[model samples]
Target: MFIKNKRVTLLSYWTSRYLLTLMIGLLIISFISALWIRHTTLENRLEMIEFMAEEMVNRITDVSIPGIPPDERVPNFAEDRFRIRDMNPSMYIINTDGEVISSNLPLEQREQSTFSELINEKEEIRKFTSAKNNKDYYAVKKKIEIDDELVGWVLMVESKDKLTMVKQEYGQLAILIVGLALLGWWAIYFLSRRLAHPIKQVAEAAKQVQSGNYEINLSDHIKEKEVYELVSSFKQMAGRLEQLEKTRTELLAGVTHELKTPVTSISGLLQAVNDGIVTGQEAEEFIRMALVETSKMKTMVGDLLAFNSFAVDAVPVKISQLDIDNFMKDFLAQWYAIQEQTDIVIKIHLLHKEVMISVDLIRLQQIMTNLLTNAEQAISGTGEITISLSEKEQYVSVIVKDSGSGIPPEEQELIFERFFRGENKKYGIRGLGLGLPLSKMMAQSIKGNLHLVESTEKGTSFEVLLRKEG
Candidate 1:
């Protein structure tokens, strides 16, 4: 599609290569055909010359006149026959001494005729096809032989039917070819437009997709198979983009919901403290509550950022060999104080006593914290939160289970998105809804899946997969 050479385009759709090809091919073929037809004409003339030479020589030798005077004219038939110039316009003859006895056209000088000249110079014979005077002629010249002696030579010439027709045909062929080549240019222009038009439309559609307009309309005007298919593909792509945009919008609305609550609560409590509504220990208590809410707000914001983080400069994974059991145990100590507060039983179920694995310790702890926090929030007073691990042939799996009001099937699927929250909750803190999303993102970044195994009215369970150590 890109042209490196600029000299080519003489016509709108025409290129130098195409024009050169047509010209060269037509010229070569026409020239060769003309030569062949001309050759065939000369061959036929050769036959005619041979026949005429034989006839002329026979006429000269077989002529018999009884006592005809040398100075006087002979009988009518003999007189007319001896007059070689009167018999044929394209015929010529000569004596043994290369002198003309009789002629059709009178020559003022003694120079031999062209027909005679050719035979005289070549002695054997020569044939030629000439396209002089706008007529193609087949002419031949040869010496007359009798008793192994040369009396004279005769040249006979005639025009051929096929040669003349082919000669004329070359002109007509050239015109026809020129016309057809022009038509080819027209075809290229017309067809390329039909092709490029749809592609341009597709390009525009792609631009609109980038501009965040996902709903695209396609024209059915194109009847070509390939163009139609391209439009159809663009339409499908636009539809998918529309669905993704809808999902993104929903996510934004949800994040707004999460951020609004704590901010509102913090403002109200601070406003109460500043107005001198509560003083001394009461003011201190209100300030403490506001700080707690502010901390909670900060955590939610950090979780939101952590969950949706994507770009080139993200921290690379730092893997180290360590006992996952010991790692979890040391980390779980932070939450040990919480288990003592509630009547819920906490248990760790280990398939292997100690399984060594490689991962980022900080990120792994974050994933664990998120999962455990969600579990604790689900329980009201009396329940169990269990952490278990199992290794398959190729992968290791970790599970967290809680005895509490299970996640509703409808809400379970959406809970891992930013700012998503449970519909039914009697809680101290319904967070700005970023925990599960952060957990999911962390798990995915480590090439793992976090999934709900099962959820009932009494409990909910979650599974996490990770690659096993060799």
Candidate 2:
């Protein structure tokens, strides 16, 4: 009944080490208990016999007369004159010559050798089994004396049937102990199987997963809540793996399509030049167009390489502390000079003019450059790009906000994923979509995070959080 699923054999469960050890321990305890009971029973019976024997000696001496032979001096015990207390033993009187003078034994047993052997015996107590009746007995002897003269002996003989009855009762108790032990063994066997079955199910599920089969259904196997949670986690992991495989397939297709465009264009241009389709100024213009396409392809290839390197930590970070206000002022000046843009209004806001924080200067600059590039592309005409810096308790924040066409709500989260392109590609000749993802990776390597803080139809703001120096 314990093996409800019938996954393992009952014999094997019972033969497990846990149940075997418990049964053996119980058996040993029962045996020790039986031995102790037998010992205590014998001690109590002997003590009772010793105390009864001592009392009989005192009674006999008080009844006897002085200066007379033990035979005639003592009145016949069978008569009412001299009496001894009878406490379930056969009491007897014997003279100095080993002949019975008086006895409580049956008349036919008076002349028996079993009775004759006990007369005038100096021993305190002896055990004997009678030859005629074939029954066990305890015999105790006390001397009968008058005024310090030894007259005769008084003997007390008791049957051992009571002791035998005590042993039989103990035997019943041993049987009960054994019965209870067997019951306990069964209970343990079932309990152990209950505990082991859940673990076995988990092991089987793991084997399936190792073989690339993640469709494990543990609904039928109910166990503890924790085990259920483990099964649930495995299911979730399998689903994620499936999604990743789909994404990988899509990435391969996209790469093939993107690479083919520039290569096809290059092949067409060279073939046109060889055919002499045009001459003079037209030829020069075609050569310049081809160079532009080649440059675009080169930039895409470079982005791919950078993304791959950042993914595996192949690029190194050089950490340094810099003044927040001064560092951003210099960075913005260099960026604006490089762009040579006169229409964009670049504003700067600083919570602290001189907040020093630790960062990889090169990596942080690259990340901010990527964000600014994305913002400039989003703007169609004259717009404001605001760079705000603030210090928090544990981190320093750098937010870049642009007054341009914002990202769509649905595409905000996926924009940071590798090779993910948003809906707004209006700037012409879109990038390979690795810039934001690679920037995010670089941020994470420095124990920081880069995220789109907010985006709406009005504008979008991106924030970079860096750990503040303690």
lDDT of 2 at 329: 81
TM-score of 1: 0.54
Task: Determine which window of 10 residues in candidate 1 has minimal summed lDDT.
Answer: 66-75
Which portions of model 1 show Cα errors greater than 4 Å?
1-167, 203-215, 220-226, 241-250, 270-292, 304-309, 312-316, 319-470
Please state the error at residue 363 of candidate 1 in Å: 4.1
Q: Per-residue lDDT for 139-229 in model 2, tens only?
A: 8777767777877676767777654346565678778877877787677777666655766666787788778676776654656677677
Please provide TM-scores, in order, for all candidate models, with all chains considered together.
Answer: 0.54, 0.61
Q: Pick the candidate with the highest TM-score.
A: 2
lDDT of 2 at 139: 81
> lDDT tens string, model 1, 101-145?
444444553234354445556444444445344545555555555
Each model's lDDT: 0.66, 0.73
Global fold similarity of model 2 (TM-score): 0.61
